[model samples]
Target chain A: MFLAFVAATLVITYFSARKSSGASAYFAAGRRITGWQNGLAVAGDYMSAASFLGIAGMIAMNGYDGFMYSVGFLVAYLTVLYIVAEPLRNSGKYTMADMLAYRLSPKPVRAAASLSTLTVSVFYMIAQMVGAGVLVRQLIPGVSYEVAVVGVGLLMVVYVVFGGMLATTWVQIIKAILLMSGSIFLSVLVLREYHFDLGEFFTRLTAIESTAPDGTKVVRNFLTPGLIFKNPWDQISLGMALLFGTAGLPHILIRFYTVPDAKTARSSVVWAMAIIGLFYIMTTFFGFGAASLMGPDYVQANGGTNMAAPELARKLGGEVFFAFISAVAFATILAVVAGLTISASTSFAHDFFTNVIHHGKEHQPGQEVLVARIAAFVVGALAIVIAIILGPGVNVAFLVGLAFAVAASANLPVMLFSIFWKRFNTNGAVVGLLVGLTSSILLILISPDFMGENAIFPLKNPALLSIPIGFLAAIIGTLLSKEVPSEDKFVEFQVRANTGLGSEKATEH
Target chain B: MNDPQPSAADKPPIDWHRIQRDPDFSALVRSKARLVIPATVFFIVYYFALPIGVGWFPEFMEKKIWGDMNIAYFFALSQFLMAWVLAAIYVVAASGWDRSERTLLAKFGYTSKH
Candidate 1:
């Protein structure tokens, strides 16, 4: 099943490679993707292995606290639809930095934005890479963690380097369909176990019996809150990060550029919200099914938390169902990493290399695409090496959470201020990005996740403090700087953003 | 990829100041802001209420409305519905904005291909 998925995706890459040529085609898929197509790709890019396997496992183990992650993930899209999507599609050409560089000083703003983009992407990519390794090893015996990591990494590199965004988008769309189908089937089987009785399902969930760490059997209600998150502040902070993070995600933002116009972008966001919202709601059935039917203790003893969904499949539908679910998980990881690699490489080539280093000019035609391909290879290799070094024991969930924190704090504030605030200048953009990036990392280092009992920060997620600091830095930096704000450029940007008067159009075939 | 013309050169010179000063453009912006700002604030407040309610008033939130379905679990499930409804409303509202945008562009002598 896994090999069949791999072969299907490679065939997609072959066709995409034949069609991809110029910078526009390679980067934005010729801006020809329909609303629903881009919507599926966006959902595919957004839902990672962490979301699929990790969230289900979390709910299976921690109950209500795990479901909190789902609420925040879907709500985060409103921020995207209302504020980020249309303006970004109208104003920017390639990457998130393109939007910022539209109104601010190109070199400084592009450099700062590119750094944040790479930081968020690398953090996100490493988590997915580590997850791929751990998951593949468990699903298929005789596969080492290091070997799995390298294989996934190389495959992503091949997708980005040869087929570019077109292949990556299709891979994600296909993965999304498979994931939704798998989840639906699993949810159905779980419901069938209870004869589709909601009362019985909820009754079982309320009293989940498990063995304690001290060898005592305990019965806990999975419906109650505070299972995993002890502190209210930690819960609120995580809520803030996830509530605002999706808007700032580089890979998610770049998908807006795949469509023809702002209206399509608008419709695509609606489609994504529908698909994503439904998928998250179904987690209740499968997650609680794992806890109520198989029991958390059994799941933990079998293969730990991340295997909750697959274990439930094995229990209810036998080995064949388990294998199919495992392959879907593998596809999930590959699609997410491919999306991340393209966004990172696009930022590096477009913002850092072509715009920042070469002063917004490519030395030759097709040079930007060439540079992006090289960057994709380098980024993939780096992720593989780091995942191998860190090994599978490192917490993949923490890294993904940190990526959201960085995005919410660093990328979001800067991008928002650039579009809405006329006084926002190069200094503000630079300061906002640097301060947000550094503060989130610093707070995480001192938090309980890293420092154990000696932790200074009480909250596990840093967005509660760091996001406010990011917005403040932008405001203060803009006020303190002596540079004069250019009204003409701001007016131009507003017109384009509002009416799509001079935005990039879809390329003709 | 087929076209040799760079993307930048294809765009005609736009009278940004004129569009910015137009009353129709202002109305369009005002209409969007009226819906988006309040809708955003409402959803954010509604979303945060879950964690706050669960954390601060666990006993109250734990009260079962229907067979083991506590307020906490029920509220979390409602968020998915809230998001979908809000998105549908936004999409519906945006169609009006699209019409206004088209009229504004037409006044400026540019016809949108889409």
Candidate 2:
């Protein structure tokens, strides 16, 4: 059943790529996408299964605090809207490197930005691949885990290789709509079945708690997991990364470039917000419904609360709902992977190959596009290998938080200061990116999650340390730099990006 | 364009007077400031408010809404909505620009129309 869905998604990609206009079309949808459509695609790209399944599962398992994921996810969009959307639309040449290198020397910034984008994207891609492996295994009763991982990986490569961003964006838009509609429908049905009696649901759940032979009550709350230091602190740090980190994510940020203007970027974000909010609300219900209906024994039997939504659907909607949820889960992986590939490809082609190597202007457009498509295959392959080794046990949602922290700490500071501050030089931009990326990674490594249950790491989230470090690095680096960039390059980037008339106009004037 | 005019009397050694003119430039300054100031203020408030609010209202947040969900859940979810909404708003509001603003932006190497 899952294999069939994967094949269909691949076919969609092949057909979608028939009219491809080469690299720009693949990377930024030819900058022709409408604001609302792009917004939906952006939302699609941003809202992964980690959100749909994980948030609900977390909520069902943890209780009131579990909803922090949704809060963090939603609020992060505001940060993107206010700080990034217009400026990125106005500054970036084609990728993160374009934005950073435009104001400073192209050499170091391009190399650094490309490496950062690739590192984060690959790390993120592994998480998605891991998710794909899990979903495929769970949905199909007979399929082995290895088969599922390879199947999803091959299908993802096909999707990206053929469809590019145009096909990917449309796919995401459709998937987002479907995911939202299905979630809403499921939430409503669950509520109607209970006659809006949430209290009754909880009351029954509480009353059903079993007792041990010693007479101690069975503590069956889903929110509190069996891990050491499984407290609210981990939850809050995870939330900060998801919320603010969304603003800085390379894959999501690149989506803004698809629109023709800053205004469209703005409009897309609005549409994305409305859809995301509605979907989250529905997910909360799904979580609660799964917890109440499936019962702790059943959940424990079927691999814990993470499987709550699927098990509950099996109980309520039966085979059809199960298939539907599983398909949606698969689509979530596809949409996110598509977005990640595009961002990675953009970094390689636009940032490294064209900008750094070509000194911002030597490559034929066609060749550059070809290099990017090739890079996509390589990235996909790497993700597949990592996923196979790591297996499917890792928490994808948490990794997404890590991705955001790296992006926010590294990309956001450089991006924010470059356009607004005149003193920002190339040296400053490069150091800032390096410092931010390094510090965040270091902090995360020492974090409790990375400590491997040893209780050695004192902190859970490095954001408390890294976010400030990123900001400070950018500030101090800029202050210490002596070389000021020539005014022409900054003007050139802004004009080409903002006007969409290309570089000719800037040079002509 | 105004014709160039020069004072016959040697300009004051200290250059006592400075040329200041153009209502449009003034208007541009005001318009730009209007957007920049509020946006900056809002950003600081939103980013800083959550950590502070979470610290201050932990007990209140512990209260439930529907079943297991609570105030913290709602706020967290709303933040995601806010992020996207804010992006959309920036794009919509910043796209339009007058000729002078365009020229000034162009002078700075940014194309004004996009």
Best by TM-score: 1
Worst 10 residues of 2 chain A by lDDT: A500-509
How well is each residue in A270-352 modelled by candidate 2, as lDDT tens digits?
88877887777677688767766665456656644445666677778888887887787788888888889888987898788
**Candidate fnat values, all:** 0.67, 0.24
> Where is model 1 more than 4 Å wrong at Cα?
A394-398, B1-12
Q: Model 2 residue A295 lDDT?
A: 52
Per-prediction TM-score to the true structure, in the order listed:
0.97, 0.84
lDDT values of the candidates? 0.89, 0.68
Lowest lDDT sum, 10 consecutive residues, model 1 chain B, at: B1-10
lDDT of 2 at A116: 84
- Here the TM-score of candidate 2's chain B is 0.59
Worst 10 residues of 1 chain A by lDDT: A392-401
Residue B13 error, candidate 1, Å: 1.9
Q: C-alpha displacement of B78 in model 1, angstroms?
A: 1.0
